[model samples]
Target: MDSGLGEGSSGYSTMDDYESLISTTDAELLKRAWRNEKAAPQILRYEAALVQRSREQIKLMEETVEEFTSSGVDPLTVSLYQMDLDRTLFLLRSYLRVRLQKIEKYMFHIRKTTELWNHLSRAEQNFAERCIEDMEQHMQQSVLSKLPSSYKSHLKQSSSSEEDDMVPEPKLDTYVICRSKKFLGAFQLDDRQFLSIQCHLLSWRMNSFIFLMSMNFWTVLKTLLTLKLMIYTLYLISL
Candidate 1:
């Protein structure tokens, strides 16, 4: 692997360094974003690079899996590689989704801040535009849109209201509930069932804690009794 380092230093040994560099870059971008700086351009650039790298990695892993299969490598080893590819794709998708979510959440501010838009690089502006369009299309196709007609009507009314000065930022609890619903649905469980399981788990944990504490209490009591007996025996011997 080239590691994208200088030619003299390009080797597998530098891959870790390259990873650290990318991680550091991401951290800096996130910090800027947290401070509400015009970091969209940098974020878009980083996102593009990461997406490209993920695609290349996925392709390479697929090729490697094919070669291993052809060479009659153990099924377990090939499966592990397949799992890695799956995880890579999952992470890539998650990364893009989160970026889009943030962009969407802050779209109102982005639009009103002329300086922010001006600060964006041409590539970043393009990415932002395309991302907005894609997010709208996705929402149209998503389960959210398929929700009850009443919900759809409510959304339409809220969106068309002219009196609203700005889009309200999503509540943290709402975001958490949305994510939790998706997570539960992934395992074919509803919120009620998930809650039941959570309660059961909590109860089990409490019971286990009580049992351990009781055992510890008995151990301490026994130790104290033994020490008292030894003290009494020592007094008798001294007498």
Candidate 2:
């Protein structure tokens, strides 16, 4: 979620919903993080605390599985526990793998961009640095070595280039399909422009309005009965 946006309203409606969300298991949190990372066009903020807790949980589960195996616990129970452990491991691994893929794909752009670079975890930052070093060396040997000195720079097409035009950056202008949990009416794009966004699936440019799609800002209000009824109808149709 974009920390820059003010907390207009929470996605959760009641104390019970908030409690339920906060009480979610680390495994579930990891799954959500994994899905979000996969769907996002650019890299997302690292879930450092959630990842650490998940790792600790995995270690404990591994030890428990080993003990259960040695003690000859019920076969079905042990198998179920093993399955849960495997699923959690897969989620964590997949999440990290997706981040690594994004880092690799945009290593040069990420390193040069402060906001994107700061979003990475320390380990991911190290990985990106190493990746940049390796890529530069490889480019020099395999491609840049044969080019003239003016075109030898890894991040530029030529020495005369104004910027790192050769670097691969994420496509912020790309349109994305997103859904909001709550109805946010008449979002202003500029001083004279506004867009009405009821609770529905929307297609918009990622660069222009990503903050509106943040889960944290999907706030609910009780003031729009007509809109609520329409949304309820849409939900029923969807079901």
Encode model 2's per-residue lDDT on 1-239: one tens digit a residue: 23323233333235435544653778767876787677665787798999999999899999999999999999898999999999999999999999999999999988988988998999899999999999989998999999989999988889999999999976543223333333342343321222233334322221123322222111221112212111111111111
1-239 per-residue lDDT for model 1 (tens digits): 22232332333335545544653543333332332212111122234554566678778999999999999999999999999878776666555555555556655444445654564446556766876677557766884478765444322444456543434432211100001100011122223322222211111110022111111222322332232111010101110
Worst ten in a row by lDDT for model 1? 174-183
lDDT of 1: 0.42
lDDT of the structure predicted as candidate 2:
0.65
What TM-score should be assigned to candidate 1? Answer: 0.36
Number of clashing pairs, model 1? 0
* Best TM-score among the predictions, by candidate number: 2
The residue ranges of model 2 lying beyond 4 angstroms of the native Cα positions read 1-23, 180-239
Write down the TM-score for model 2: 0.70
